[model samples]
Target: MRLIFIIVVATSLMPISAAPAQAAPLDVKGGYYHFIGDEGGDVDVTAQAAVLRNMEALTQYRSIADGSTFPGWQKEWINNLGPGVDRNFVLELNYYGAGEPTIPRPQTVDGVVVPAPDMTIQQRPGDTWKWAYGYRQVTSGQVDPLLKRALDQLKTMPYAETVNIQLGSEFDTDHEFGTTENGIAHGWAASDARALTAVQYIIGYFRSHGLPAGVTFSIGMGGWHRASFRRMHPEWLRGDVQVLQWNAYNHGTPRTPYQVFNRTRAWAIEDLPRWRTKEVVIAEWGTTANVGNQAVWIAGAGAAIKRINTDGRGFRIGTLTYYDNDPNWGELMDRDAGLEALRSVYTARPFIG
Candidate 1:
């Protein structure tokens, strides 16, 4: 999503928490995301600089269209890196066929391999098509081959020591043809069921197939998604999916770094069951150039992140990733204030796994 650049602007900065002693620093990482297939404007050189500055987590969104070959474009720059770059890799994997019908190998339930469901594609209004499973179509068996493809590809890459797989992008605010079709579910209830089932299968599949030690799987959503849609079934937070991902963008509304932090924390942490915990990662975050003071805003955001990480709550945040624009939007690196501020945040503290 693009953050429109309007002339109206605001700026505010709240007190950042004092840094803890060096003996006990916060456990958070600074990172940046390169949009899929963006090759212009020194993108690779800029990304290399981010890593050299200790922004040790890098992500790229990969939307695999149905019947397309698995992507190896990451290797274009990754293979050229010098020794000891030491960065964790992440891929926000989105399959265009996520909501399509599938009859993969017979599904196993309670130790019995049952015949797969007999499903057919159904045509909906506006010439749209959905699988027989209806709105909730991200089934494990249907997406298994894609997942396998990802693991197999990653195994052959470098700097993929710690990998994170975000199943799909923000479905809560998803739309098609100007309508509110999430492509995953019609309502929150169905969303919960289908999401949980798909994740559980993912966890099991990863366990059986060895990849890396610190690999994590997550569910991604827009930070503005309603609390009802953010429900965390105890089943999701336990030993299954280890992370929750959200895109954090104020669109000039919250108007301050602290407000942005609180808004995101509420959705990523407070909205869930208090007893359960999972790593929260801001899969994408940014400020429009025309918005408030980008430097102060980013500094305050970094400070707020430090405050949250040191709060003794089990809300272990993984990464605060800046959203460098995709091919369609303006790049964050093009904004001097935003880029410098992110570099300042990354250099201020060390990130731990």
Candidate 2:
């Protein structure tokens, strides 16, 4: 208002003259902001692409500060520029996110009576790690006990502001979860009626139990079952799944860098939106035996993350979390070689949620 008033008064006082108007300072509050840092030494594409086109400004911002890790550097960046002056800041992290909601009675979908669920996901930005509530199979009779146990554990430790209710490890599709019948875990697959019911139950439980308001839930499923199931019930898209925690891997015995890139991209970009999920994530992605040339594959993967705006709503890929736990199949990423490979990307584009 002050700037506008001054301009109006000055205009009235001065005679009409040939003078160029001064440009106003930008209000960075509402603009496109991207996070280029890591939470725990994850991949950073912004650093690897020294000459990344359309990203020089971001690159320059990062160059001025130095820190042992991303969090360290982020503090420095904020001190230098101050918050809200620019639309970029480390996302407000939540340590004790509420567990899922209670599962309600099953509802009919496509004329087939299926379990009904209720849930919601926050669509902000931050890099996250989906630690498995751990189990090869879904344990117990109802979804409440299993979910309650996990929530109890989360209550003990409060650090992460976001939690992704990932379904079955990338390899488990037997649906060995919930009330089983005669040795079969039925209906709880991602696209199945029970899976949706379970997710909604968890969300309701969280609401009733009272987890912090800032905490958020990011729930989704893995396997061809859920993705394939979406075809029969497209209306499922109108639900509260915040991020698509789908897993993608190239199982070829001797995969090359480009091959790995292509495979990863197909899942994160090419295949995810078919389900109509707005925020996407490659919850589990990596190569086994031939985790091919880490830097090369990561850069290739970054290319897909960089170009993800198909629906015209600025639908960008939010995060890429690699499967680093299973030692049975892939190269141990904990080793220096893998860490270094990861560093290249982390150094380039550090973080996202």
Clashing residue pairs in all predictions, respectively, total 0, 40
TM-score of 2: 0.48
| Location of the lowest summed lDDT over 10 successive residues in candidate 2 | 23-32
The model with the greatest lDDT is 1
In candidate 1, stretches whose alpha carbon ends up further than 4 angstroms from where it belongs are: 1-27, 36-52, 64-71, 79-140, 175-185, 232-237, 267-270, 273-277, 326-334, 350-353
By TM-score, the best candidate is 1
RMSD of each: 11.4, 14.7
| C-alpha TM-scores of all predictions | 0.67, 0.48
Q: After superposition, how far is residue 140 of candidate 2 from its true place, in Å?
A: 11
